[model samples]
Target: AKIKRVKGPYGKVHRGFLKGLTLVWSEIREVIREWQIHGQSVWVTGHSLGGALATLAVAAFGEEAKPIHGLYTFGQPRVGGKTFARNFDLEYQARTFRFVNNNDVVTRVPPRNLGYRHVGTVLMFDHAGILQTDLHFWNHFLDRVVGRIEDLGKPGTDGIKDHNMA
Candidate 1:
């Protein structure tokens, strides 16, 4: 996965995601416009890699002065850098919800060390499958420990299992 600098409301974005959006942006924009014309709200959603593309699509719509009703993503990876994240949050944070299941590893990348960051409100499901919002650091750490312990007899890591949409 490569990172590319883009000249727009989105300062930097995942290259692959940008390419994917470029391919279908016209149709997506048209659909949104049609929905708006019919007095319908446009909400976007996706899981994993599709989530990244959905984020970029919303950003594109915002740049074009199109309003989006809301966005929801499951087990989504980071799609851009700090600037892009800040911009996205500024424009859409109130209407965006990111759902992370337990230790789903997909939500943790591209790493913060690499300047990638997540945007919007996070609604996480803990190791016990309990929904958590605004979790404290200590609580998050404890849940991770519990998840690892529970994975002791499992064939694969909890990260993969938690990423399952089901």
Candidate 2:
């Protein structure tokens, strides 16, 4: 069967791919639950569309039984209206770092100030940002400094790919 060209919002000159937001959030929640790691802080990080979607998921968890712990992503684009950032910032009470490379245009779309109240957002502008040497160290360190959250694995090697998150 030939693939039909669906037009409109999901098409050209229109926001054709803005639908299915709820589904994405639902799946993210389910996966976190499946992890079965409760009472231990959580961090939602992603790249590109994953970042926007993950942000939505964290926002959805706001005021729930379990609140979002942190957020760190790269190459992520804007997801919703200006109010989105403001509202999300208000709802989320955690460390949020949004990395953006100068060459990556994905983080520069949809314009800024969407009626949302964001405390602040850190934008990383190079591949060095993704450098993880301590794996999940900074997250744990932050958790300790902030709310005494349970710590994860030991610090990874210096300059290690996963440790750069620190």
Candidate 3:
């Protein structure tokens, strides 16, 4: 695959992710070739930070690359800005599945306001559970990391708890 820095609205990304991919590209290609020699399919998966890396790896593989089967990511934060996201979505729409907990705080980081965007189909989970309605220092943690559900219609209560892996 052609190597170049992938620029995003917020900043350049090929330095961080793509550079890493390039460093190992030869080895990865060799591995894939070896796998293909045995008629094996390649499927990538990761969670949290690993998911972000997997997303980049798949992109580096190129859209039409053979032997790569699909990607499945969990609680992956935004990896790049709109352009990268758009390209990734377009290229891998049929194969990428991004699973995000409804309120996973990590998924909301490097916010869109900062020009970061998410790619792939977001498989959101809105699991029902008791919520801690009262505000607390752990509100974001509880709502997102703990996956609790407050009463939806209650005054001052919002269904903000939905971020847990559970």
Q: Estimate each model's TM-score.
A: 0.94, 0.55, 0.66
Report every candidate's CA lDDT: 0.88, 0.49, 0.65
Candidate 3: minimum summed lDDT over ten consecutive residues — where?
Answer: 155-164
Query: Which segments of model 3 are wrong by more than 4 Å?
Result: 1-26, 129-164
In model 2, what lDDT does residue 21 have? 46
Separately for all candidates shown, the number of backbone clashes (residues 3 or more apart, or on different chains) is 0, 21, 2
Stronger candidate by TM-score (2 vs 3): 3
How well is each residue in 3-93 modelled by candidate 3, as lDDT tens digits? 2336532334434655555677688778877887899988989887777777887876764365467899888777787778778777786
Q: How does model 1 fare in lDDT?
A: 0.88
- Which residue pairs show collisions in model 1? none
User: Poorest 10 consecutive residues of model 2 by lDDT?
Assistant: 5-14
Cα deviation in Å at residue 118, candidate 1? 0.3
Model 1 regions more than 4 Å off: 1-9
True lDDT of residue 155, candidate 1: 94
Candidate of highest lDDT:
1
Q: Which model is ahead, 2 or 3, in terms of lDDT?
A: 3
